[model samples]
Target: MSEPKRKNRENRQHGDRAAALNLFPLPPETEARLVIYADLLHKWQKTINLVAASTLPQLWTRHFADSLQVQAAMPAARIWADLGAGAGFPGLVTAIRLADVPGVEVHLIESDQRKCAFLREVSRETLAPAIVHQGRIEDILPELAAPIEAVSARALAPVPILLGYAENLLDKGAVGLFLKGEHLADELTDSAALGTFARYEFSSIPSVTSVSARLLVVKARAG
Candidate 1:
């Protein structure tokens, strides 16, 4: 393909993604905040490795849309903890989208000080109800004063480890919303073999953004 043709095709693809984002019920203010968030991400991504550089071209569909699906999975969750929230995918996005809702809080857990700073900046700029915790997941998750209603992690760890990381909150009734790619079946098998679930009920929700991706929802079953 010629250079100009390729460039035009790429631009059209980007435009299509931007249009696809409109399918969600995001408020206009939320959309504006996401634009600011995307700008900050691009600026900071230059110095630090926030996200995979290759995915930057499809930031709207690849990251933002993928994250938004998590919110769609559990719309009623007001209190959430996003583990390993690098560049704040679904966590920061959720906070931004739900900025209008009262009593909403999204805690973003990230150990990197620089990334935490970035998260803080976006939260401050967008007025998203996100609290950046610059510490390990194990240390910070256990000490949260507010009861987490949902726990989220994307491309962070395997199913077993994720369950272990959020076991404290999950045992206390918080649902776990994990974003997994094509290896979800294998992960679920491994999770079962490892006895990861003592009381949690696991269900898989298909992701609207990618066919290979899935939203794994873990909720504690009623006794």
Candidate 2:
């Protein structure tokens, strides 16, 4: 009988095949990294549940592609920060894609020490410009002397709670590029109720699944 791990690899390969069929026009380098990242996820998953069990096989489409969608949405971003970056979606992959670009940096923030350690390993292995900050977003925001051009989060939490953690730099001009699902309208309402923001736009997510996927870009009004 074959090892269970080998079976899981076979299943993961099947998932990668499905993701390849999607063809969302990712950069060549990014496409390569996606494959590597998928393998890494499968390996790390044995020790830690970084991603949802059901989505493991389809990591490419469910995670990488979903994150790459932001590329088209914000083509010329320079600096980026992924708040609550669990497993480096829209952050590590984002940085790897932009790795060659001069002066571009992507920061992946995570409060969990283990997650941060894992993120660091991936960053070093991939030579990505992502640095994992092992600290709470809320606690670190007030002290981050430098500012980032954009902020991102996926499956983090309500927009209000999201922005609350991002309040420091967000009060400045940094744009919020949050990955959201279909129920964005409801979250937007709740976010507004939390307090006022500047401007925001919602774009439908481009993915293989017909499900509701959207990117919410929010900006603060100029003072």
Please list the residue runs of candidate 1 whose C-alpha ends up more than 4 Å from where it truly belongs after superposition. 1-17, 191-194
User: What TM-score does candidate 1 get on C-alpha atoms?
Assistant: 0.92
Worst 10 residues of 1 by lDDT: 190-199
Instruction: Name the TM-score of candidate 2.
Output: 0.84
Q: In model 2, where do residues sit more than 4 Å from their true spots?
A: 1-22, 191-194, 197-210
Per-candidate count of clashing residue pairs (backbone under 3 Å)? 0, 2
Q: Encode model 2's per-residue lDDT on 1-223: one tens digit a residue.
A: 4799899888876767556546566567766666677777788888998998998766777787777766546768878888888988878878877877888788788898878888888887777888778888876666555578788888898777777776655667777877877777787677445444434333444434326867777777665
TM-scores for all candidates? Answer: 0.92, 0.84
Query: Total backbone clashes of model 1?
Result: 0
- Residues 1-223, candidate 1: write the lDDT tens digits: 9999999867975685565477575677888998898889889999999999988877888888889989888899999999999999889998998899999999999999999999999999999999999999999998899989999999999888898899889889999999999998888777455555656789999888888989999987788
Model 2 residue pairs with clashes: 198-221, 205-213
